[model samples]
Target: MLEQEKPLRLAAFDMDGTLLMPDHRLGEKTLSSLRQLAERRVTLVFATGRHYLEMKQILANIDIPGYLITGNGTRVHDLNGTLLHASNLPEESFKTLITHKWPTAASFHVFRDDGWVTNQDMPELLHAHQFSGFRYQLSELENISASGNSKVCFCAAHDELLALLPVLQTCFGDRLDFCFSAYDCLDVMPVGSNKGSALALLTDRLAISLSECMAFGDAMNDREMLESVGRGLVMGNALPQLKQQVAHLEVIGHCKDQAVSHFLQHWLNSPTLTYSPEY
Candidate 1:
């Protein structure tokens, strides 16, 4: 139980594994709870590793309005699709990424302002299309430039990705930041760009302090966001690496079980919810 001396004015959520269910739709129970929280004048912001267009598609049916931190925090946008802040990997970093000869089974993706590009036709690409609601154009690596690119991603089997991690880190460790948005997916963004920096930018723009925010996430990419917020709650399904490191983080029910909804419902209904965090 974390103490809340100041009222929680903002609730930031990571999309894929935090707010959305496995099928990518918000359960009625969770949807209702979020709506109610918004109705109470509490701000809701999505701090996710998803692309802007993908985030829009996922929230298409729901009318909940909030800020968006997409592309692993390389881009930040307001509800009306206005770009608040955006960052891109330098040409050198992009060159290094493109130069690498990834395994044939691995799919490389580059996100552009309007859409995304990929090099292979694999099941992972199809999964990306189904999940993101954005069709990608197939382009050769040599033709792909770093201009206007937000983030670069590599998708492979979970175990294969784990094996590839060390190589990637060694090659681009100083130039890029890496985070596992999912077990099978690794996102590489510009250094100093992540959910925490994005959230700080959003809060500064809105005149809110970190102490007045509550964040929820379930991946390694979400570590900074969870740690930066006044109250960071990890979904029961969070990565072992994140859970073990963020010792103060409180565990909630799994995302599939609507843990966020339950927790917010309790916070909205209880005025005396208080406990000091380990950090």
Candidate 2:
């Protein structure tokens, strides 16, 4: 059987760029498709750089038991919000992230188990978190300890973040994973914590093989999970770097057009619909 013909037991999704509209709205068509998949006994996993609480609110439209791989996989929760696995960056990392001389445009945030705390609110971010009504607590970075936190984030202009990337890698690349969660946001999680590793743990516990799973994503953070699954589909709106990074993965329709919803519909009704050939 062609790889895509394999029995699909799980469908993993990355929010923001891959599963959500540019405005961060979850399309009705997408929710309906996920609900149908749940009814079919297919496991649904929403994995992203988002916090669990935020994801919970965003996914309120779907009433079913599913998994949440939040904080880019620093935290994983099961059916009833029971945490399956969690890894936290040490306090030192948080201090360094806070103290580092980031670009003047950078707005920093620390994500802990309780909630997020930011140095200041960047109004531009409102559009992305508005749908979930998730807001951060404003606090000085010095007071925010990284302990119990999944990741530290910095938001700025796209170019500024790109410039900061190599500097971060040079400082802590071996101890942590740095990736762009969005054009303006960079997330730094503990080295071993990521969507791909988290998915493997969840699937192993559920007795599902990697070959039975498919994933969708559109950013550098999604790279590991995309490559780990048997079938990885990259969104047409995926970051250009991501497309070049995972050239072997199939390219699919745009997220703004509800491409994931369309793909799920075809997977259920017509498995032979050809996806964009791998670039």
Candidate 3:
């Protein structure tokens, strides 16, 4: 049996390669594990770069009661679809990005209590639909100059996104947070905003202590979250730098399917199992 000072109160999972399979589908094993965790009263939350609309489908498939930390950390919502909290970039930042000649096909997304708005044309909006659920409109960036934007995305090649980071940083500075959500997509949010901060806020509202929380991630955006949680798990496919920075090393399978579920089964079943570095 596992020695326990206290039972884990929460389990925050990063979507893409951490919880969902590469095809953006949830496997039966993963869903089963989630059900088990929920039954145990472990507050399961998702801290992902995806927005709520995009996350809803996956949540429906898994069928669990939990909070969502979407847009990296800009937006937080409850399982009942309540908007608990949100952070957004200033209008000036939006204008700057829209006016600037971004290498990739850039898009702007803004969220409020009701829903989100975007300033992309039809073709562009259709492309975004494949990734998120927010309604896309053809409002020009200048028209929404005073609008509050929750997140901005730039879609391009891997190397292209990397190259644009420095430029964006130089232009936006501490005004915005930037990271690649996928190989061809870069996510931007307000500074001082991230999955970790969102988790902190959610924990506070739920009256849960940081020490009682466990989080899983597999990307650079998840870095702060992994560092902030009590036990941060890094997936086997995480970047070398990300793996090196983790406080505790827990090896899990890749994002093919049920990797997280399998690991959790072993973990909860054998609490006495010790963790060792894979590298």
Per-candidate Cα lDDT values, in order, are: 0.82, 0.85, 0.75
Predicted structure 3: lDDT: 0.75
Give a tens-digit lDDT track for model 1, residues 1-279: 334467878899987777888766677889898889889788889887767887777666577888889888899888788999989999888987898786536678898888778878665455544745677788897798768888988887888888777888888767888888998888888999999999999999999998899999999889999999888999888888888989788888777877788787777777576522222
Candidate 1 residue pairs in clash (backbone atoms < 3 Å) = 2-275, 3-275
Query: Against the hidden true structure, what lDDT does model 2 obtain?
Result: 0.85
Instruction: Look at candidate 3 and tell me the lDDT of residue 236.
Output: 78
Tens-place lDDT per residue, model 3, 1-279, is 112786789999998788877666667888888889999889999998776876776677556787899888988999897888888878787778767776555455555333555665546445434534445555656666456568877765667778888988988788888876666667887888889999999999999887788888888788888777778788877766577777465656687755788778876687676643321
- Count of clashes, each model: 2, 0, 0
Q: How well does each candidate superpose onto the true structure, as a TM-score? A: 0.92, 0.94, 0.85
Q: Alpha carbon lDDT of residue 132, candidate 2?
A: 74
Model with the higher TM-score, candidate 2 or 3? 2
Better of 1 and 2 by lDDT: 2
Q: Which rank order by lDDT, best down to worst?
A: 2, 1, 3
Best by TM-score: 2
lDDT of 1: 0.82
